[model samples]
Target: MHQETRLLIGQISDTHIRPKGQRYHGVADSNRMLAQAIAHLQGLDRRPDLVLLTGDLVDKGHPDEYAMARELLAELAIPCLVVPGNHDHRDAFRAAFADHAWLPAAGPLHFCVDTHPVRIVALDSTVPGAHHGAIDEAGLDWLHTTLAADRAKPTLVVLHHPPFASGIPYMDGYALRAPERLAQVIGAFDNVERVLCGHVHRLMLRRWAGTVVCSCPSTTTEIALRLQPDARPASFMAPPACMLHLWSAADGMVSHLSTIGDFEGPFDFA
Candidate 1:
């Protein structure tokens, strides 16, 4: 049996697998990135109990892409939960990963987990044919009821879109359409621990309604960060990366950034 006392969760988001099996940004092989990340996970001393795949598993919401996603994820030795982003096809995703339990099916895969001291809530914020994210009223109601149902366990909310903008203009524009409502819900709950998201293709952390909000980076490509206003945005010279999250009742949750590559140049420089 698994230990509910403390949990190690691995997150990989936004693979954007090219259907034709094309390379990304002319370097940093995409499929190989996933493979290498798995190897890295295997090397981890403390293995993750579960893997959360935030979104954008496929580049264009194509079945072929989801098929590739299955093949890539199948190499992992841990259980995984998947959600869809604007670029994903829900039906296709469901067909690909048929084993994932779907409930309160308003849309983008809403599920809950009682893994750690803090319960994990996976929300679907993707609206079909759109980039911006929104949690429908029914979903929000479910969230409210779900939180109200349990106040003992601190909760961590995971979604595909950042509830708030991440300072990047293009991505910020496509952020959660109505963030105040999200904030209000979290604010209402003293047990809400942290909020997790992926879509900006970078790591973004901010405080919202007295809770820690973090957005994980992409598994394949990263958007150019826009610290300064410019007609053009940040570039993708940076490699594909993900975040490994460690959670404990004694210490809370800690997220660590990870790259998706395996390089064997030099163990030691002499």
Candidate 2:
């Protein structure tokens, strides 16, 4: 049997879903936005082969919120992989998403998903009792050993925190601690095609460690683009979106942003 060479991955992050009928920060309706995102994905011409919920699955570490997030995500037609963020409770997340075979029964929720044309390495960067992210020694060792085992496969490293600092001051303050460690591991691996992340609540693309690191925008709120000292982070109702990563034998890997919601389109240039 011949394997499919082309692959499409849908990535949604920073959902921040609150308990039923509740809004994020008392304004953004996360549940409604997530539903719209799911509907849009369902109607896409070429549906994604798999979906990844990068992190921040809920606003608070509550059982009800995890239940709600899990319920909403269950609507997707394709397989979904998940990781926990600073705002998430690992135990609750594991319980809610136990059906995913990649998820472990305990410890850091890290695993590898092998699909045609690409392999995804989901890293757990959340630190207990802290908003900032870290990979710790054990996680780093695991990452190093994992990448070394299969050096030929095209890999996409998924994590909740942005390894590098974004220009936005307030958001940068919450960046991953000692990112150089993560950088060293990735730098050693030439097969890593991209690093996909969430938690920044905005779309960011850049070249790091000889590979591309792209952060997906939140499905709930858009973070303010304030690039200055003492700039406070704020989210607005700009637009909810997800990242589409396409990979093939010929083209390698490329990503595009799929903005969710009603819009005008199909205008021809003829």
Highest lDDT: give the candidate number.
Answer: 2
Q: Which ten residues in a row have the lowest lDDT in candidate 1?
A: 99-108
lDDT of 1 by residue, 141-236 (tens): 888888888987878888999888677776677889888988888789888878888888889899888888888888676788666545465557
The local distance difference test score of model 2 is 0.90
- Model 2: per-residue lDDT, tens digit, 131-203? 9999989999989988998999999999999999899999888889999999999999999999999998899
At residue 170, what lDDT does model 1 achieve?
64
Number of backbone clashes in candidate 1: 1
What's the TM for model 2?
A: 0.96
For this target, which candidate reaches the highest TM-score against the unseen true structure?
A: 2
| lDDT, residue 1, candidate 2 | 100
Error of 2 at 5 (Å): 1.2
Candidate 1, residue 143: the lDDT equals 86
Residue 238 lDDT, candidate 1, scale 0-100: 71
Regions of model 1 farther than 4 Å from truth: 1-4, 24-28, 103-106, 115-117, 262-270
TM-score of every model versus the real structure: 0.89, 0.96
